[model samples]
Target chain A: DVKVTQSSRYLVKRTGEKVFLECVQDMDHENMFWYRQDPGLGLRLIYFSYDVKMKEKGDIPEGYSVSREKKERFSLILESASTNQTSMYLCAARRMMNTEAFFGQGTRLTVV
Target chain B: GIQVEQSPPDLILQEGANSTLRCNFSDSVNNLQWFHQNPWGQLINLFYIPSGTKQNGRLSATTVATERYSLLYISSSQTTDSGVYFCAGRNQAGTALIFGKGTTLSVSS
Candidate 1:
């Protein structure tokens, strides 16, 4: 079975603070993604990495950045957190194109 | 980017009842997937049906790629099945999947 693990289950940060969410996958997938889930917005992509050092901005990439220094790990960084940034963050990995993506248990972020 | 929409934004059912959920996409897709997000917020991959039909246990899914739509069927629903169901699709040029707003399912005993 594929396993995607996130660094935290819940996090609270003060305004303007830096936040980092880490994700690791054991399946050696080539694509990794970060998404934020809101009540009415569903899951909006924040950022995605197709290969090491290669990143692309998704629909809602503002206020968020991602790092993929290695194939197995992907990290999402908030330049400076704000209350509006609070949401359930999810990490997913897919083996390649045209395949099912596996997701990690989301991290509920609360920016105060 | 492809646009995905799911029907019956919310559904309520009793145990042993069956239900069907629908997903419609704005364009043709190379990959389509179904996911069940449990109450605890875990996205569980239910099916990777880009086309045709696939079944696992009491849950089955069918994707008509040509028609740009998909359907998910849950039979003999249980209380544990209460959660949100999401359908996502990816066009040939994109690596990321665009998801629908999801259908919230509530099953009572």
Candidate 2:
């Protein structure tokens, strides 16, 4: 079974603190993505990486950064946790093409 | 870049009922697919029909690639089927997917 695992199922952070969300895929997929889900805005991509150390900004990249130092793992970083940054974070991975992408269970982050 | 639009943003149904959800996307976005986000916030890929149709148990999906549209049908709906359904169109580059706003479905006993 293909699996995408997130480090935490829930997180609470203080405002101005740094946060890190981790994702790992066992499928050996080359493409990995980070997305945030909000009540009315739906799911919006924040960042994605196609290969190790290669990253690209998505529609909602502000206030967020990502790292892909290894093929199976991708990490999302919150430079400074803010109230507006409180949202459910999801990580996904897929092959280059012709395959279905899979997502992690998600991390529900609360910024106080 | 691609833009996806979904209709009937919200829906309510009784158990054992049937319903359909629609999604439309802009040009050059293939790999049309559907996903279900359960109340627990886990997303599962429901279908990957770039074109034609596919069925899995009580759930089925169809995508018209040329028209850039897709439809998901639910048959014999149950409480477990209550969730947000999303449709996405993958960019030609295969780098990422552009998703529709999603339709929230509520099923009652």
lDDT by residue (A1-112, candidate 1, tens digit) is: 5899999999999999999999999988999999999998899999999989999999999999899999999999999999999999999999888788999999999999
DockQ, all candidates in order: 0.89, 0.71
How far out, in Å, is residue A110 in model 1?
Answer: 0.3
Collision pairs in model 1:
none
> Interface Cα RMSD for all candidates?
0.7, 1.2
Model 1 CAPRI quality: high
| Global Cα lDDT for candidate 2 | 0.90
lDDT of 1 at A72: 97
Instruction: Please provide, for model 2 over A9-93, each residue's C-alpha lDDT reduced to its tens digit, 9 standing for 90 to 100.
Output: 9999999999999999998889899999998888899998989999999989999989898999999999999999999999999
For candidate 2 chain A, which ten residues in a row score worst on lDDT? A94-103
Per-prediction TM-score to the true structure, in the order listed: 0.98, 0.96
**What is candidate 2's CA lDDT for residue B94?**
51
* TM-score (chain B) of candidate 1: 0.97
